[model samples]
Target: MAKQRIGIYPGTFDPITNGHLDIIKRGLRLVDKLVIGVATNPSKDPMFSLSERVAVVERETHDMAKVAGVEIDVMPFDELLMKFAERVGADIIIRGLRAVADFEYEFQMTGMNYQINPNIETVFLMADPRYQTIASRLVKEVARYDGNIEAFVPSMVASEVVKRVNESKV
Candidate 1:
């Protein structure tokens, strides 16, 4: 039997978009086990709480996790990404590249992550063309203004985004 290869896909995923799901689905092809690392990004304020973020991912991806043979686990992690990868026994870190700008930023981060943990590798998956322009920041901006977001996120996630945004206004 072949050894199980673990892949870690780390992100804030404030309100995971279909674009993010596209990467997760494609990323599963490279490893036996896919671990979605929901990290706490200190730089940006998230519309959803950590628990809410995790629930949204779980709810949105429940069907995929159930039907896919590749084992899937979504868990929250707070330490350094490389450290989290190491702790989880990840052989590779999966990243999504939507454009050249993403590559430029990920390139630097990849170099640093490699330096921190040379044993692990980073794999970049190009965004599905349909999802290339969809981004969480832009989605949030739209949601805040009561714009339609059904196209970008799962129906459940869209509800959560709207619910959270409306609650904040009250």
Candidate 2:
């Protein structure tokens, strides 16, 4: 049988972190093609716009040769995630699980996506221990208090966060 043509990894990626990159890197190894989907959420306020987030992600992964064959795409969707996966021509969906909390939510999503498209499978990758507790919300919270997020996010995004926070104060 031929290998799957494409795999989709979707996330809000408010500020892409090393954890996310880890999954992206690993997921690349398991499929012929990998697409990083930057989901748009209009219901909640996001610190950075979709365009900004896309640029930050693109910059961060620009020099990654391991996944050089992988392509990154930004998506703005208010519909079901399975539809998004199908739209991207992906046969597999990549998800990163940080903890039990994430498992519960991911489990439900996986089932729903399966129902939507049985051919599309959700693959869950465990987050490294070092990043198990890291999340975009926490990163922003720490930055809000003027804490360094250098370790949480990519350098490009870290600088972006600093710029956004500083601009918000004035």
Candidate 3:
């Protein structure tokens, strides 16, 4: 039997913007199974905790898994990304590119990841034009100032972001 093509989509997913979801949905099309690795990067000062981030990804991607007929798993990892991919048995690492600036950063990371594990390939998916400008950081910035974020994130995530922002102000 052929081996399953497993791919890892690792991110901080602070509040999982629409662009992230878009990447997950599209990434599923390229692999038989996908592992969404939520990173606990304290350096980024994420809006959500690792557990909260995992729950948010699970809740948001539940339907996509069923519709795509692809097995999806959400996991939290704080170790090196290549190590996480190796642990997940990932044959590919799925990345989303929004613009040239993103590519410049991703290109360097991809090269390093490749050097770490040549067997694992990195695939880049361009963000749909509509969501190209939507980023988790900018989404939080907008929500922090009471700007509308429904267009950038799911309703649940939008509410969560607002709640967190409001709580932080207290």
Candidate 4:
């Protein structure tokens, strides 16, 4: 039997935004299996906990049959990402590039991951025009100052953001 082509879509996903969803949806078309990895990065302060982020991802993607086939997981890692990909048995790493800035960073990471595992390829997906500028950081920033983030994140996540923001003040 032929091996299944599995791709790992890794991100801190402090909150899964529509842009991230766009990448996952588009990437699923090219691979047999999609593994959405909600990475826990200790270097950054996340607005939501790792478990919370994972639950949100599961909630937002559960009903979509196409995405339901995609496995959702979470990992706390401080080492190279290639290690996580290997653990998940992913032959490809799906990355979403919104602009030149994103490309530069992803390119460097891709090189490092390739060094760790030569068989693992990094595939970059261009952001949909509507989400070209959307990012988790910007989403949090907008919500921090009370700007509407309805269009940036999924409805489930938008509600979480509002709840978190309110709780943080107490």
* TM-scores for the candidates: 0.96, 0.92, 0.98, 0.92
Q: Evaluate all candidate structures by whole-model CA lDDT and list the values in order.
A: 0.91, 0.82, 0.96, 0.82
Tens digits of per-residue lDDT, candidate 3, 62-136, equal 999999999999999999999999998999999999999999999999999989999999999999999999988
Over 36-146, each residue of candidate 4 has an lDDT whose tens digit, in order, gives 788778677999888887888777666553545654443454455788788878899999999999999988888888788899999999999999999898998898889
Output the better candidate (1/3) by TM-score: 3
Q: Kindly give the stretch of ten consecutive residues in candidate 4 with the minimal lDDT sum.
A: 65-74
TM for candidate 1 is 0.96
Strongest candidate by TM-score:
3
- How many residue pairs clash (N, CA or C atoms closer than 3 angstroms) in each of the candidate models, in the order given? 0, 0, 0, 0
Clashing pairs in 3: none
Deviation in Å, model 1, residue 109 alpha carbon:
0.4
Best by lDDT: 3
lDDT, model 4, position 57: 77
- 1 versus 4: better TM-score goes to: 1
Q: Clashes in model 4: which pairs?
A: none
